[model samples]
Target chain A: MSGDHHGSSAISERVRHVEALLEARGLVDEGEIDRRIDEFLAGGSPANGARITARAWVDPGFRDRLLADANAAIREVGLSMAGGLQEQRLKVVANTEDEHNVVVCTLCSCYPIALLGPSPAWYKSEAYRSRVVRDPRGVLEEFGLELPAATRISVWDASAESRYLVVSRRPEGTDGMSEEELAGLVTRKGLIGTAAV
Target chain B: MPDRFAPGDAVRTSTADPTWHTRLPRYARGAVGRVVELAGHHPLADDRARGLPGTTQAVYHVRFAAADLFGDGDHAVTVELWEDYLEPADPSGGTP
Candidate 1:
């Protein structure tokens, strides 16, 4: 019954029509669609959320503000940080160079919606969600990040109440650097807890 | 998802009604452990129900070493889990 709507194909065709117009006007080129989706998969990196997460990590004051109210703090820097939202809030996490951070709903794919856009497909896959909690060390190893038995693995379950984001630690060589400089050191994987410094 | 289970609230799997969501691993199905902290509760997170905006209501945490889970290892990794997945253990009981 829900199929009653004319379907998204109509909308898609209209969008393609606009794309053709923009291309004809020299505003865009062919294959831009492929490039765009690739960008989206890359943690929406072009949006510069990683930079924001990293800045919050270096500055305790900002970090406090972000954790308290992730959406507002993120917006201050001009990012639309949404928590596991009906578009409600935002939450941030810090993943230091030495220490890594990864989020798993374990129950569902509850992620920091605001700072980061939609959750990744792999994030929502049973392979990741099931394995991480049961064997954190093993799963991380698959990502090519093997931590010593001593290094603790903290997996936060992103519930509906509060959204969570990984505040990746700044790179080792970045000291006394400006906010812009520090932001450059941030990476999408760093935000998800696979990489560090 | 309250005082019923803490971070290390010695518990085993509840085979009684395993139909809903569970945080215990396949290996720790019958294992018992203690809760260490009280991770707040949220809606149930199930994948079968996609586009499910909300449904997670579970308190999470580090489940301390359960004798049964890790055979001979003296030290066991802490397993975080939700509360509805656990129940109070009987001193003499192992699985219930």
Candidate 2:
């Protein structure tokens, strides 16, 4: 987090301004309803989704299914994300080798709430959101991750309809590691394209 | 021209919220762009917080060169943005 309270307040004020824009536009049916479905399900808890995703990392078949269809993969983890919206086309992309993956909705905070938890504070920042889309290499450098020139960097811009998850590479020498240990390596920022663990 | 904001327009960063919504990304504030295009608007943060079907005004994709955003990069990168996410650009606006 930045050491500047003013910086944080600026973000809050911007959020407030947007809310006012929404209200003035008569955009919502009510104040409590959630625009993003899974955001509502977590009820102030963000990491719940990440916990589910981390467990599936070690399960080979589960990982396969996840790579195949993230929506069902998450339902297996008890996500109501599949709640009624049958056409939920979610994709789980993994980062392996020297290559890495990061998700951004350069448009909005369009994260895969059904799988990963609420985006890390930095993930939603213009510092991240803009730089990741604009200067992904520079942003990744901040995380101490510099992709080899040979490695391919794929940034998935998640939208309200499309969500993405970075199935982080199980760090080197992690064989025989339990699911708990694996989870330790799956930081929220890693999922969003900032860090690996 | 309903007084709606666009992706490339100049917009100010927020410092507070009574509706308790998620905050906008930081690097975007005060940046300028052309009205690349308009994305749809969704229910606001307060509605999302209330468990109602909510959405936000996701604007257009304002294209920014990587050098402009990252400062030292010579690479090229593009940005897609929302309306409220931006306002209009400053004629002499510099980085914050």
Candidate 3:
């Protein structure tokens, strides 16, 4: 872990050096990088994903669209996975009575940042990446999610062009809740499939 | 190019260990899996990483049993892989 700290700072230093060079050459205007970062940060948050999930729970049609075509479905709520040069493909997997779904990027932390905000440190750590694909039940148990032995577990590795999102099953006794209130129950971990709503 | 494999087809990942960048992880290499879905065509990440003039290829969502990769689990692991990284699996190749 200590090495990670040093490694990160070294990377940051290198990035700063490159940024300074770009700014000095007038290739990039000063403060443009910060503005872009701010723009992305303003649009990225867990709330975005929560709102989408809440709509899916309350509107069956929206849920169907989300499951069928996530990239287009997100635009219904004025959201997009288009921060980069090209839009990233999104695949929404829903949890059902017979199965559970979880997402991971073993090579690197390729997450749905526009919807889920930044990934948690644990998600990017070597322990979770290496072990989850191998021992999912054990890892989920450590996360306090104890599933029945018969329940199937699906570990999605986002190693290619597509990203993944897990829609946790709606909890019981919440039919009276409104869409906004339902969104309140969603969490980053829940969207990531590490925890239930 | 047309999709070389379709959903429900059995495929095996390439075991080649290239020094260049690749999206294929080591654990899934040489593993037999079933194609679950077509993830559409996209530029190959390995060639793109190296700044090569890569062409678009079909990407498939392949599902592999955890027991096949790790030797002791009932769960499944799915990965989106480019067509170039996979080949038709031998019919006699036992369940991974």
Candidate 4:
């Protein structure tokens, strides 16, 4: 199935060729590219999303606001989806006991990069993308999540203009935990609905 | 901009030309689904991809039954699709 390594290597070479051409023509500079990389690296992480989810878990009003308008709601928490010059709208889906929610980019790796930082390699992998949509439960099991037979899964496919975030259900016995403690339990996988919180 | 379809509307995805760059997934074309959420208006990606003058189009989170999309499964696949790629499903059964 993995056709030829040379084919992919050719793609890399062509990409390098385009980059070199652009640089040679003064259309782009390595410093500008590095600065952009640094900006993206410093922009956001799963921790930011965890904090937002934690705040929502503790505050019902914020949860309502988040479900209503996610972009504005994140701004209310002092987090803005800026940088990368890409579309920034985000839609959050909450997991319930009867219905579980997961996110995938079936077309490509369209994710909430401004909220959860760069997506992990597994998320962008072809295996994850193709299998997750067809067999969500099976895929979740691979991620070590075995849902009850009665539970229904809802898979959200993100696209260019919009992104999705899965708000994992607050774990049991965490009622006494503070927002920071709760945030610590919100993994990137949990936010993506691969693993539970 | 006002949304063409509401959250609960039964709509069918249009089997539009897929030769060019489009956000509409190939698997979703001509499939019937219900609008789960109105994702607001945004620039039509189909237009943006072709380097044409872009205009806003209402987007919706359409939910398809797992069985409808992949034979059988205890799940639903919700995808964000633009307005132009969807048409109102007929009450008689088939997508017009």
Query: Top TM-score: which candidate number?
Result: 3
Residue A185's lDDT within candidate 3 is 95
Predicted candidate 3 versus true structure: per-residue lDDT over A109-139, tens digit per residue: 8899999998898988888888899898899
How far off is residue A76 in model 2, in Å?
A: 2.0
DockQ for candidate 4: 0.76
Write one digit per residue (lDDT tens) for candidate 1, span A46-98. Answer: 23666676667567888888866666787767766432114544446565434
> Each model's TM-score?
0.57, 0.54, 0.93, 0.92
**What lDDT tens digits, residue by residue, belong to model 4 across residues A1-197?**
12222337877798788888888999998667667778877867999889989999999999999988888898888887666686478898889899999998877787887678888988888788888989999999999999999999999988557788888999999989999999999999998999886
**Model 3, runs deviating above 4 Å:** A1-7, B91-96
Worst-scoring 10-residue span by lDDT in model 4 chain B: B87-96
Total residue pair clashes for candidate 2: 41
As for TM-score, the candidate ahead, 2 or 4, is 4
Weakest ten-residue segment in model 1 chain A by summed lDDT? A81-90
Tell me the TM-score of model 3: 0.93
> Which digits, one per residue and each the tens of the lDDT, describe model 1 over residues B1-96?
235655435676545535544444455556566665554555554432354675455555544442455454323444455565667775345545
Give the interface-residue alpha carbon RMSD of model 2.
5.1
Worst 10-residue lDDT window, candidate 3 chain B: B87-96
- At residue A56, candidate 4 shows an lDDT of 91
Order by DockQ, highest first = 3, 4, 1, 2
Least well predicted 10-residue stretch by lDDT in candidate 3 chain A: A1-10
DockQ of each candidate relative to the true complex = 0.10, 0.09, 0.91, 0.76
- List RMSD in Å for every model shown: 9.4, 10.7, 2.3, 2.7
